[model samples]
Target: TSERILGGLSEQGAPVPQGTAAVISDPVKGNVSEADVSGAAGPLPKAPEPAQIEVLTNPSAGQAAATPVQNISTGIVSAVSGATSERLSSAAAEQGAQLTLEVAAVIGDPVRADVTEAQPVGPDSGNGQSPFSLAFLVNLSGLIGGAAIFFLVGGAAERLEARSLRTSRTGLWTVRLLLGLAYALLIAGAELWVAFGLLGVEHEASTAQVYLFLALATTAAASVTMLLAVAFGPAGIGISAVLNVILGLVSSGGLAPLEALPPFYQAYADWLPLRYVIDGLRSLLFYDGSLDAARLEGGWRDSLWFLGGRSEAARLEDAVWMVGAYLVGAATLGYLISLVRDLFARRERPKTGKVAKAAG
Candidate 1:
């Protein structure tokens, strides 16, 4: 009816039928005319809109566009997870393999480790294998060698006075000792790796144990350095320098046996730490342990006597004695030097007064 009224107005500027109520209905609901309805008829329910039907009919079009993206995300997550799991599995397997290899390595070195029990099968045989001797030699020499070199320098440095030499009153001692110990440990460790890892000669139970041995050896070397410094004072540094030279040249790493050097160096072989260190290293590598049977022989007896005590569990006594000796030696030298300084002071006092009185 509203449309008819609008149509009449557009066509001839005329009004709809006078006093007639206009009825409007949706096309699908069936078109009702004004003649069918009375004036008392209430407004008919509003017709359903076409725009609402169009929206409801195609609600999933946006979802359809997003389907490919959802699928791609799921696929990517699955691929990344699968790759990560595979890599973790492979890494675990590799670590297991390394552990197995290490175990196998420990099992294989019967020749170097079990020297007393393990022997060559054929007719070509050497007699009397000793395991304790081997281990004792290894453990003792590194300690003794480091100590000897440290003190020998002190004994020689009793000659040079610090004032005469154009050098620092006291140099960087802690840094020097630290460096020395570091170098010593470095040499020992590298050689041990070659001996055990490459040559398959020794079996270190763990890296921790090796570290412990290094710490002990470094400590021994440091103690000796302290003793030398105390014994000779500033001159002791010179002693350390000289001793370090000999130790570096002769007893360094696999370069043991000073006798093997030039002919002139042969006498030093017996007393030098190189031979002892080599013997001690062999003991640690080839024998049972540090306090083996072979270490009881010769100068090693003194080392044991000095280090040993009444109880088997007692700590090393030699370290105490050695340090004490270092202190006593230092005190004696200091006393002598003090007297020299006092004498010089006394001599310089009177000559000036006598010269002034004569001139007046």
Candidate 2:
């Protein structure tokens, strides 16, 4: 209508429609009739009518033009839904009422969640979950405790072997095993006391399970270091420190998760006791010792494929058992090597005796 009103006026003045009984007095032309105006202007070209938009009742009609409008409408609806949900959530939160915010989306009425609103893995801290807490567990329990046990056991074993006080290799291994168990238990206990008792850190797992994990980790480290010491002497201590402390710390996946590590570290993540210890601690401390809870709450299910596709229960069980395996395997291997050394020493002693007799 505005287009008609505006477009109808021109340089020749406003053109009257046909059959309009209106008098026109023009400055240049003395008087003008409606017929004269219409005839002169060649039936005053009619203004083009605005297009009337109809509802897109079928998919076949104006699909190209409808697509952008449909997208815009969908976006508007989604934004409004999100805002309304946020408002309701805020209101409920203020009233101390618990509510699950249901977000509405455009596609087939599917719901979309705002993941940012989800709670984080560990305790609610101002800065979110710190890597420092994880590092503290891995370094204190796995690296420092493990390395200390290694040196304590290895140094004692070194002194016995140096003084030739190890009469029976079997007896020596038995002593080492007993000593390792004692030291591991003490280390695990002390560390737990420091963490839970002194630091006031909270854990959502059984104390026995956490203590067992730490003990097994330290025992495994002691077993491996004792094996190296019995086989390689003093050099074994350096090797143990490098393997269980330096390399272990890097590959532990405590500071950075397994997926974030390089491919080589990811490949060997399962073989290392440090990785399992850290993973177990994380599960116990924050995830209630349940792999499913960790996976669901921590968002590790899809990303961390190194879990070997085991069920949640199986994975949680394996985390502890694998460290125990390391302890048993290392201890057994050390025992076997001691047996072989004793056998060779016995054979050499008889040959040397016979040679000395011939010389005499």
Candidate 3:
């Protein structure tokens, strides 16, 4: 049997059976001869050769080309109609090798290539200006312009008091307060017109709404300054400056959201009149008077804490009330201070007359 062979000789760089030998367990049976083993095994079969595939290369321009088949990547192919195939072949010839296309597998189908052009880059693509830039300018203008009106009104009040001989103390205070308010309204209206009308600044609120908020804020500020000047004399101007310029601007939340500030500042913002003004203006200009929607969503506490809570309606209401309160309070206090001073002067006059009678 072929399985009985133990060794073989090399032929054509591979092993070929030399002979077949048998192993018999019985002592009586003699060992099989090498010639008997050789006769038992047959010749080995011949190995097959590898198959070849043809690859086409680009031909020289001078050479007459064959009907060229487009080289397409391996994928599922779909059938194309005869008319479509003719159109695709003509397009390929016109574009030459510049256009590459994928071929569908249908027997007579033609290949179609989708052509797309690259988009060019532009200089201003991602560099548009932010609305905050305009906001910053407005804030700066408000500070400078508001301060100038305060001083101008203060000077006029001083001149009017010096020239009027018959005007009582009460009358003078009233005149100063009215002058301050008038100045506030004038500056506010002028600045708003210049910014929105002439300069073409963008804002969410209507021009009328902006004017109302600005007028309220400016009047409150101006009234307070006049009251300070009346109470403390010339030194009061510095006090007003510190309050309106330093504390007001920092706590107003104009540069950033109040919530982003430290807890102390956030708390301070609640008491500042400028905060209400700026918040109200922003609600109108940036929020498009939609802060009421916010109040409804967040409830009263949230709306109050964040200075408009949830909506523009709440913000405007709060701003108007706060500014009006400050204006009324300052005017009342100034009037009381003047009345007390007048009372003291009257009481002192009687004492001076009695002393003069004793001396005579």
Candidate 4:
């Protein structure tokens, strides 16, 4: 926008929004807020006849940015920081539905239409019969199962690795983190395999599932794994492993709905919000969550507090926030536990009594 305004001042002199900006906003066809045109003809003694704008609008950086309706600075997805972000943005822009929301919507869909783009753009994908598929239901069941196993098995290994890495150099800790991430990724891959080959679920992984799960899981798992490594001092990794699996199974709702899960599961589930992270993927895949759907569902309304109001991407934005909370919270808990332990370890020190006396 800064570039558009400044560039307008330089090239077009007093700016008419000659390109796509004027088209989508329909400033001319629609109404431009009078304020934006404050410097128009009235100020210029002989303002050149309002510069004629070309009819066809080219999609450009400037035009893609829609003016915010409220706090939301939409279209920040266009200016992604990395290549992955850029590709996701491009896919969303080109196809309103990404893998998560659009594809996931098809779980239990007998039509198999949701797996592919709808021929006529209906939920059923134009398959006259079997709009809801048994195969889809089976696959959804498999997803929940796979997700459960992914977390449990992956987490268990992570715990062992952390314990092994304790007392090692910082470099070893870094390696532990890397290996932990690998574990998370491997879980996803392994689950996909189970979904396909073992269960014969026939569900193809979507961009949304792969990316969202990997991202959220990796971020949270790394922090939690680190906490286990330092604080448990040996057993942290294994504890984290078990916790990850349980968290994945109960919280994720991959097999069962959140509301349907037993009471104890719900009790622990809230504390383990990784389920929300997982649901985010399902919501994206199955619900085909859009700006409108997001508005209706009230999903991740304010997820971009971390970024400088950049990337208001609904699914991706929500995923980041959920994972970020886990990461920060787990790390904080890790530090607190470590601090408490250090104090307790020194409790028996000869000077400890003197120090306690002095402090008291």
How well does each candidate superpose onto the true structure, as a TM-score? Answer: 0.30, 0.56, 0.51, 0.36
What is the number of backbone collisions in each predicted candidate, taken in the order shown? 7, 0, 11, 20
The stretch of ten residues in a row with the least summed lDDT in candidate 3 is: 61-70
Q: How many backbone clashes does candidate 2 have?
A: 0
Per-residue error (Å), model 3, residue 227:
1.8
lDDT for each residue of candidate 3 in 1-360, tens digit (9 for 90 to 100):
122111111111212211212211121132211112112223324322222223342211001111111111000011122333444445545544223222323213433332221221122211112122333333344445444544665566568769863335676677666766676677668877776777665566788877766766766676776677777866776777776666655655544344435666666766666665554654565456554311112233353454444433464566566666777888899889989978886788799889999999
Model 1, range 188-241, lDDT digits (tens) per residue?
576456545664543323444444444444444444445455556556645654
Model 3 TM-score relative to the real fold: 0.51
Model 2, span 1-360: residue lDDT tens: 222322333332432322221211121122211112111112213332222222222111112222332333333334333444444444445555432222212211222322221223433321222223443343444434434554665568678879866565766677778877887788778877877787656667888878887777777777777777767876876786777667776666544445446767655655566666655675676566775321211223343445443434454566666666677778888889879978987888889889999999
The order by descending lDDT is: 2, 3, 4, 1
lDDT, model 2, position 99? 29
Error of 1 at 63 (Å): 85
Candidate numbers sorted by TM-score from highest down: 2, 3, 4, 1
Among all windows of 10 consecutive residues in model 4, the one with the lowest summed lDDT is 58-67
lDDT of each: 0.36, 0.53, 0.49, 0.40
Q: State residue 270's C-alpha deviation in candidate 1, in Å.
A: 7.0
